[model samples]
Target: MELNILAVGDVVSPAGVKYLRTMLRKLKQQYCVDFCVVNGENAAMVGLTPSHADEILDAGADVITLGNHTWNCRDIVPMMEDCPYLLRPANFPPQQPGRGWGIFETKAGPVAVVNLIGRCDMAFGPDNPFLLMEKLLPQLDTKLILVDFHAEATSEKLAMGYHLDGRVSAVWGTHTHVPTADCQILPQGTGYITDLGMTGPARSILGVLPEQSVAGFRGELTSRFKAAPGPCKLEGAVFTIDTATGRCVHAEGVRIHEN
Candidate 1:
């Protein structure tokens, strides 16, 4: 049996959420996706609210993963505690509001999903992700494990992919918002992608207003970044995993442009 798992990039702003509402279902159906995970930390531009999480789930994500911005919205704290489908970074200290990984029942059986954040250039430090994984892997009961490494450095993300090569089914990077072209199965059979890109404004700077990002870069300090206004596109990748072996046999990027 083969399962097509889709991992979407960070969704930025309310517009990105609305765009996801409009496009995700069709994309899943088009790709024959059996399971889906979406990074929704930026759904509210910085952090997602409970409503944002709900909307993303309704849009088609089986699991909603978060990143460093996980706590930007205060309201999500309670939701995080209640929703098992919502995950924060596992390395975010044991006392955090929500879990960093989950095991959900799928047609192929139980699929374990792990969410991790990186420490390199991210400004804040969580527990070491590599060390956390060592503790996490032995605890997971399922062979079909997926990891979403939300990190800033490409080297860090690539290193993680190699480190977990044969251990997990697929390992993908998020948070960069820029799609990476390196999509392939590692020598150990784990599917890997440097970054899954983002599912938001197509013509903006990482889902932000171009002018705003430009101004910030030019030392023109702004109050806060705003999401760009325009047609949105969904960006992600689909990994075809062999359910029997819990290894990826085929990997490819999937991008849907709003017409």
Candidate 2:
């Protein structure tokens, strides 16, 4: 038996969340996805709120993963501890609210979803994801494990894919907000991709207004980053895993843009 898992990229602002609300169900149906995981740390352009989390959950995500911006929104602080479907990076301090991994029941059996953050260009201090993964793997009882490695550096993401190649069903990168073309099944059977991209304005810079991003880079202290307007797009990837063996047999990146 095969199970199709859809891993959506980080959502940027309300625009991204709106796109998910409108298209995620149809997209899941189009791919025959059995389980869905969405990276939603950017639902508010900084961090998502409880309302944003609820909308994503209603948008058909079985599990919602977060990254460095996980604690940016004060409104979501309590929800992080109360919502089992919401996950922060596993490598975050143990005292932090919420969990980094969870096991959910699915028709294919129990599926485990792990959220991890990287230490690349990100200045935030968190435990080393690689070492944390190795320590956490033995604790997960299920073979159908899916991981969302929210990292900025492509090399780091690729290294993580290779690191857990045969151990997990699929490992995909998030936070880059640019879909990668390197979707493939690793030699050891894990489905891998450098990044799944972002679900928000397609023409913006990582879902923020391009002009604003340019200004900030130009040494101008631009106002707080805001979501770009106009057409929205949803980007993600689909991994077809063989349930019996807990290995990915096929992997493909997907995108949906509003006209």
Per-candidate TM equals: 0.99, 0.99
Question: What lDDT score is found at residue 96 in candidate 1?
Answer: 75
Model 1, span 133-248: residue lDDT tens: 99999999988999999999999999999999999999999999999999999999999999999989999999999999999999997878888998998999999999999999
Candidate 1 whole-model C-alpha lDDT, 0 to 1: 0.95
- Kindly report which residue stretches of model 1 are placed more than 4 angstroms away from their true locations once superposed: none
33-101 per-residue lDDT for model 2 (tens digits): 999999998999999899999999999999999999998898798999999999999999999999999
Worst 10 residues of 1 by lDDT: 221-230
Clashing pairs in 1: none
| lDDT of all predictions | 0.95, 0.95
Error of 2 at 173 (Å): 0.3
Candidate 2 stretches with Cα past 4 Å from truth are none
Candidate 2 is scored at a TM of 0.99
Q: Cα deviation of 75 in candidate 1 (Å)? A: 0.3
